[model samples]
Target: MIKSVAHAMIYVLNQDEALDFYKNKLGFEVGDDMKVEGGFRWLTVYPKTQSQLQLVLAEPKEGPLFTKDSAEKIRSLIEEGAFGAGVFETENCQKTYEELVAKGVEFIQPPTEQLYGVEAMGIDNSGNWFSLVQREK
Candidate 1:
């Protein structure tokens, strides 16, 4: 039986830059960063407060999981902003948006009041959009 999600994958153009964005800009801590068998880098990062769930920062490449053509397609789609990492929760959408913008993060939509909460849309370094939401009490 499924219990809970321990890790999720986020495809990136460059793992190093993604690491910089998630770790430095988003203030997520590196959970694991090591080269596993077959020279595959096993990298994961998580919010300091949410260490149980780690986001795997992976670079699409020609590997067992992807052929060269498929890898290229995925990479192209990522470059065109055709993917979204996921929604990230914060206590204050406006404040968090401002902080991320200050760190050179690009936002497509500023914080706006929604039926559920204040939400903002931003793109990661790899061109994947993610929502920042502050849920209403």
Candidate 2:
């Protein structure tokens, strides 16, 4: 059985840009940044507070995971903001939203009261939407 969630993949348009966004803007630490055998880059970043779970920033290129046609399709979808990464928990949704906005992050929805907490919707550099939530106690 799997012990724990180690890494989650997020398809990116460019690894370098994604690195800048996640590391510089989102304040995540890079767990790994090495080139694989077949010109693939294994770049992963984790939140500063939680280093165990890393987000693998993968470029959808024609090599291992994608063929040329499929890679192009995936790229198109990413550009169109068709993917939702997942929910990201924050202690203060409003504060996080303001900080991210100051750093040039785009939020589709402002922080609003939800049944469970304060929630906001935002798009990352790769055109993936993520929910920023502050859970109620």
Each model's TM-score, in the order given? 0.97, 0.97
Candidate 1 deviant stretches above 4 angstroms: none
- lDDT per model, in order? 0.95, 0.94
Question: How many clashes does the backbone of model 1 have?
Answer: 0
Give lDDT tens digits, candidate 1, residues 68-112: 999999999999999999999999999999999999999999999
- Candidate 2, backbone clash total: 0
Report the lDDT tens digits of candidate 2 across residue range 4-120: 999999999999999999999889899999997889999999889999999999999999888999999999999999988788999999999999999999999999999999999
lDDT of 2 at 101: 98
- When summed lDDT is taken over every stretch of 10 residues in candidate 2, the lowest stretch is 80-89
Off by over 4 Å in 2: none
Query: What is candidate 1's local distance difference test score?
Result: 0.95
